[model samples]
Structures are given as structure tokens and as C-alpha cells.
Target: MPRHRQSLQLTRLKKAGIRSAAMLTLLTGVSGGLYLADNKADQEAASAEALFAEQELTEASVNGWSQHNVLERKVKAEQEAAIAAAAAAEEARKKAASTTSRKSRPGVTVKIPASCNEYSGNRAIGCALLLEAGFTLSDMANCLEPLWTKESGWNHTSSNGGSGAYGIPQALPGSKMAAYGDDWKTNPATQVKWGLSYIKSRYGTPCNAWATFQSKGWY
Candidate 1:
């Protein structure tokens, strides 16, 4: 009874110990597999996060560059517009100045008539007009002769075709002598009075008027 029972109990104990060791090994292997799977998942998540960050940075940089380009283009366009406006304004100002200058005083050209001739009546009229104006005709009679001869040949009705000048003094439009008398167009005395006054005001004397006429061909 003792030997058989003892042998059976020993065998049962050995079988129990072997079963426990197998269970522990299986649990250890499962735990190691679980740990490896968890570590791989964590690494994948970290890589995905890094990739997302890189994409965001790239997009932001592209946006910033696009904005800079737009701003630069806008500035360049504004500068070009301003330059064009300034140029236009300058051109307008120059045109206005030119128009004003032309409108203020117009230049006149001189012309002589083929029928012009010396008339003795002019000398008489010039002498009387000079005496009335408090000037001595004897001192300025020589200069007056040549001046009137070249201008109107002492003819009160003398007229210029190019400059529209008329009268003994060749007054432009002939009507300018009307300041002396309403008969300036036909009266030799009136024309002579205006002519003498013009010489006094412009050249101070008939000799000076003659000198200016000789130098410039006009006075």
C-alpha cells in the first residue's frame, strides 16, 4: 500500500509543476509580442505627426512668398502710374504756357508797296508838328526826311501789306494815330503829330529814331 501510493503522488506533483512552467512561458511570449506591437504603433504616430508639421510649414512658406510677390507688383504698378501722371501734368503745363504766350502779343512782319514815293507835303507837316510839340525841326529835319521816306515816303495814306501798317509813321493798322486826331487816316498834320510823339516817347528824338532804323531796319 505505501510504495504504490507514494509513486502515484510523486508523478502527479511533477505533472502539475510542468503544466505551471508551460503557462508562464506562454504568458511571457504574449506580453513580449504586445510590447513590440505598442512600440511600433507609437513610432508610426510620431512619424505621421512630423510629416504633418512639415506639410504645414511648406504651405505657410508658399503663402508668404505669394504675398510678397503680390505686394511687390502692387508697389511697382503704383510707381509707374505716378510717373505717367507727372509726365502728363508737365506736358499739359507746357502746352498751356505756349498757348498763353502766343495769345498775348503776336509778332508782325514788314512789307513795302511799289507805289511808295517821296512827297514834299510830309516835310511841311512834320516841321509844323515838331514846332507844336516844342521840338526844333531844324535840328531833326534831316533824320525825319529819310525816316519818313523809307517808311511812307511822307504820304499820310501809305500802307504796308504785310504788317497792316499805315500813315506817315507806318502805324500798324493805321488807326493807332487816332489817339492824336480822328483825321489821322487822311490828315498829314495828324499823322505827323502822332509820328513825332512816337519818336519822342520811344527814341527821345528823330535822330535817335533814324539811328535805330539804320541799325535794325525797323524802329
Candidate 2:
């Protein structure tokens, strides 16, 4: 951490009424305005989450349907790790590097179909394999799986709530799907392929943007 970063962290510690290396690093990487205010919001949301998570747990569901709370818990641990990395290196290499968004450890974990025109379930299987390979991030299921649940409900044919964002990651304008494949709506593999690429290019990992969402409620 640079002197400025250290100073900022201390200041945030005072204002947010919490002290954790993870929160500090995440706050600093926000790349937005309303620093103290945003972090305060993040803290408020976290507190709310802690209060309601147990009640929110759905043991009644089967087949591991939407284990969002599980996913979120894992993400917090990873975020802490990222912050600790920043902290240990504070004096070793002074200064913030202009908020380089965290990169998706690219790899996927789905089985590849022999051809593109496979069954829809087969496409999903391929996507799972792709995630295991192209975006093989450690402990990232929580960060990504929840948002995917909220976005597309795991439906390959899913479309936007409004703005016409479409498919797995809900790419806005829907036409962005063209960048991946022609039959984006029907092919889960193609949608996931594009989704991972979009996250890597724009938000880094799902965690980076999730941290942003934690702060300001959107990315």
C-alpha cells in the first residue's frame, strides 16, 4: 500500500465503523465517487445480509437450487484474500495502480460437444466444461452462480427484465450475442462462452463487479 492508500484505508476504517483489510482494498478499487458514502452503504448491506441470511436459507428446495448464500460466503473469503495480498505488499511496492480490475482466472469446466448443433442440455454440459477450463477461478461459484440465478434463472432462452439484455449473462442490446455465435438464444454453451468473455473484458471476475455491487448497489 502506498502512503495515500494506507491513509485512505485508515480514513475508511473510521467512517465505515469496521476494520478489515478486505473492505479497505475493495473500497479503494471501487473506481467511483462517494467513497465513504459508498462504503457505508456496503457495510449496511453486509449487516443486513448477516441479519437475514439464516432465515433466507431454503432447505426445502432440492437439487441444490440457488445456493446464493453459500456462493456469497465463499466470495467474501476470496475478497479478503485479495485484500490481504494488497496489504502485505503495502510498503514493498508503493502506490495504487489506477484500479486495475481483477481478472477472471479464465477457464471453464463443461464437457465439449462433438458439434455445435447438439442438444440444449449438451450445450449446457459443454458450458460447464468451458467454465472449468477458460474461467477456472478458485472458489468463484458463489460470486457467479447467484448473479446468474438472478439474471437468467439458468435458462438458456432467458431474456432481459427490461433493457432487452439476453441469454445467460444477459448481455444488453441482445445483439452483443452476435459476437459469440449466431444462435445465442438457444445455445447455452455459446451464451456462457460470451458471458465469460464479457466478464473478463469488462468486470474482470464476477467478484470484482460483485464487490462494486456491494458498495454502490450496482456496477
Which candidate leads in lDDT? Answer: 1
Q: CA lDDT, every prediction? A: 0.78, 0.63
Return the TM-score for each candidate structure. 0.46, 0.40
TM-score of 2: 0.40
For candidate 1, what is the lDDT?
Answer: 0.78
* Clash tally for model 2: 23
Best by TM-score: 1
Per-residue C-alpha lDDT of model 2 across residues 109-158, encoded as one tens digit per residue: 34544542333453345335445545543314556655666667767778
